[model samples]
Target: MPVAVGSYGQTQPSCFDRVKMGFMMGFAVGMAAGAMFGTFSCLRVGMRGRELMGGVGKTMLQSGGTFGTFMSIGMGIRC
Candidate 1:
């Protein structure tokens, strides 16, 4: 199907294509958010474990969680 160049170039993308692309982009972002959360959680746990084994780790899990959430939001992460 040949499209006239000027009209084709100006055409808006269809709704279905927009929805599919949005879903794909959001999915990638969601995966990145999940990874970030998992890593932060694991780090917190390791720090907690270290407290018992004798390392001078501060109790900053709450701050870390807040930081992670804010960063994800700043990155425009969406479902």
Candidate 2:
């Protein structure tokens, strides 16, 4: 039998590493979308500068947490 050799002998990331990466990516994307939505919603409701900042902050936190949790759970199940 012939021996099989890897091209560069590089190992792939582990399941845990991939799950962590997915969680981080999901959180980042969720936070960005939340910030945009919060800004627009606040503007539509006539919220001013400071209020807009607060709204965006709150939305980003909530969105990040929610997405992170869901991603972790999903990845855990799959992995």
Candidate 3:
């Protein structure tokens, strides 16, 4: 299925609200999956991804605290 996208993909939105909805929905699912994978070793990429997911989950619902989370989930990960 095709995902939605706003103009330039900014969160404030521009075009596809479906993208935002999908992102949020997938993000939550990913957060759960990531956390589940991290129950063992923090040194592993899976663990790191899990931690990142948890942080992002909190940030999205709280309206803040995403600075560190953003950095963690930056352009380095490719999995």
**Whole-model Cα lDDT per candidate?**
0.49, 0.82, 0.45
Tens-digit per-residue lDDT, 2-79, candidate 1:
433565477544455555555555555555555566557656667556553332222234344444445445444432
Per-residue lDDT of 1-71 in model 2, one digit per residue for the tens? 43345689766666788789878987998899889887888889998988889988999888987888788
For candidate 3, the 10 contiguous residues with the lowest summed lDDT are 70-79
TM-score to native of every candidate shown = 0.41, 0.77, 0.34
Candidate 2 regions exceeding 4 Å error are 1-6
TM-score of 2: 0.77
Q: Clashes per prediction?
A: 0, 0, 0
Local accuracy of candidate 3 as per-residue lDDT tens digits, 1-79? 3446667884443334444444555556555554554433334544366676675455444332233244334422421
Model 1, which residues run further than 4 Å from truth? 1-10, 46-79
Question: In candidate 3, which residue pairs get closer than 3 Å at backbone N, Cα or C atoms, i.e. clash?
Answer: none
> Where does candidate 2 clash, by residue pair?
none
Top lDDT: which candidate number?
A: 2
